[model samples]
Target: MKVLYVLLCCVVLCLNVLASSDEEDDKQLVEMERSADLENRKRLHTTNTFIKKHVKQRTVRGKITHFVCQNAVTMEKLTFMFALPEQNFNEDPVIQHAMELELQREMHEGLDLTEVEVADLAYHEKNMNDLGSDRRVMLKPDLALLILDIILNPTNYEHFDFIHTCRMIGLFWSVKDPTSFITNAEVTPDDNTCVIHHGTTVVKSFQYDDDSIVYVDNVTHKVLNPSFVLDLA
Candidate 1:
């Protein structure tokens, strides 16, 4: 009877030790998760602060020119815009450097462009440069700034409604080669009308009035689309 009692006591002690160890593990797991969450929040706060400062320093200073083009062969429409500032905004060099670094990090970690598309962009850029095209070359920093401006202050842009749905941003270069699908092009001024021609033959034409560019709300201070901003963030 004495031996049996001792064995029972030993079993109970072993079970208590196991329960204590499990409790410790659970505590450690919770701490790890809490630490990770805190770190993430800190990172987000830093990014938001930087963006706010950058936006304040650089408001859309001048006219926004909207461009829409269509590929003749594929009929795929490409739309983009350029915000031409009258004079260079005097921004702090430190802020500019920080913004560039942050944008570079994001591009390195979260690039969504496919390899083929990237190759095509490079090829077109090289071809245009070789042919002495005078069009503005879209740089990485320019694209990042453009996106920030659009998301923050959509009212400054002409076609905010159309721009919100754009899959790609930045300048689109046309290849001058015979095999290029983007051979024919059209330009619409403030009148909002376009006529595309193929060697003196009118192939396609379209028009978009002021009604087409509608603003959902007039909140200039807040981000127009949180989801879109988060995707880029």
Candidate 2:
């Protein structure tokens, strides 16, 4: 009976020692994990600090070109008026083609005459808008006359010159017209004051007018000028 009790006590002592050793091992594993986490956090913070200290800041300079015309431009529908030189007005195919190329180079960018009917002088003009919008405009003989009248040789002299003078009298809708404009959730308008709105309008309408209208940039009205004016006469 004494031998049995002694063997039972030995077994109990061995089990207690094993339990204590297991607890110590668990504590060491937890400390090692905590040390690794602290090292990772320190490395992340150091990388962020290095980026903030060594990163270079850049500033972009924008050019602001103002209009020269001081002749109180009244708001109206966009219109241009000019008379073509008599020589280029005739229905010579070669001359017409040259005139078309000149107009494409000066006024219309990416202008392609997809269909040209020589008999009726009617054609379809596929063009790109300033905002990279694509449009195909069908121009009849009558409408072609109006467009050519303004864009053709502006000097109105005996010899042929590509540069022509034209008068533009109208308010152009820079933004989409109320009828066709789709609602954009991204555009947020400033509701703060009129000053912000006015500034935005001035920036949008810069160089809006053609070069024939505003000849020289006048310093007096440099703050707000919309047209590209020139005195060709």
Name the best candidate (by lDDT): 1
lDDT of 1: 0.34
Q: Global lDDT for candidate 2?
A: 0.26
lDDT of each: 0.34, 0.26
Residues 25-93 of candidate 1 have per-residue lDDT tens digits of: 999999997764444333333333333333344421211122222222111222111111111113343
Off by over 4 Å in 2: 56-233
The alpha-carbon deviation from the true structure for residue 222 of candidate 2, after best TM-score superposition, in angstroms, is 46
Can you write out model 2's per-residue Cα lDDT over 1-233, one digit (the tens) per residue? 99999999999999999999999999999999776444433322322222222221100000000000212211111110011111122345355334334422322222222323211232123211211121111111222332233434444433322111111111111121212211111111232111101112321211123422232222222334333322111
TM-score of 2: 0.25
lDDT of 2 at 43: 29
TM-score against native, each model: 0.34, 0.25
The alpha-carbon deviation from the true structure for residue 12 of candidate 2, after best TM-score superposition, in angstroms, is 0.6
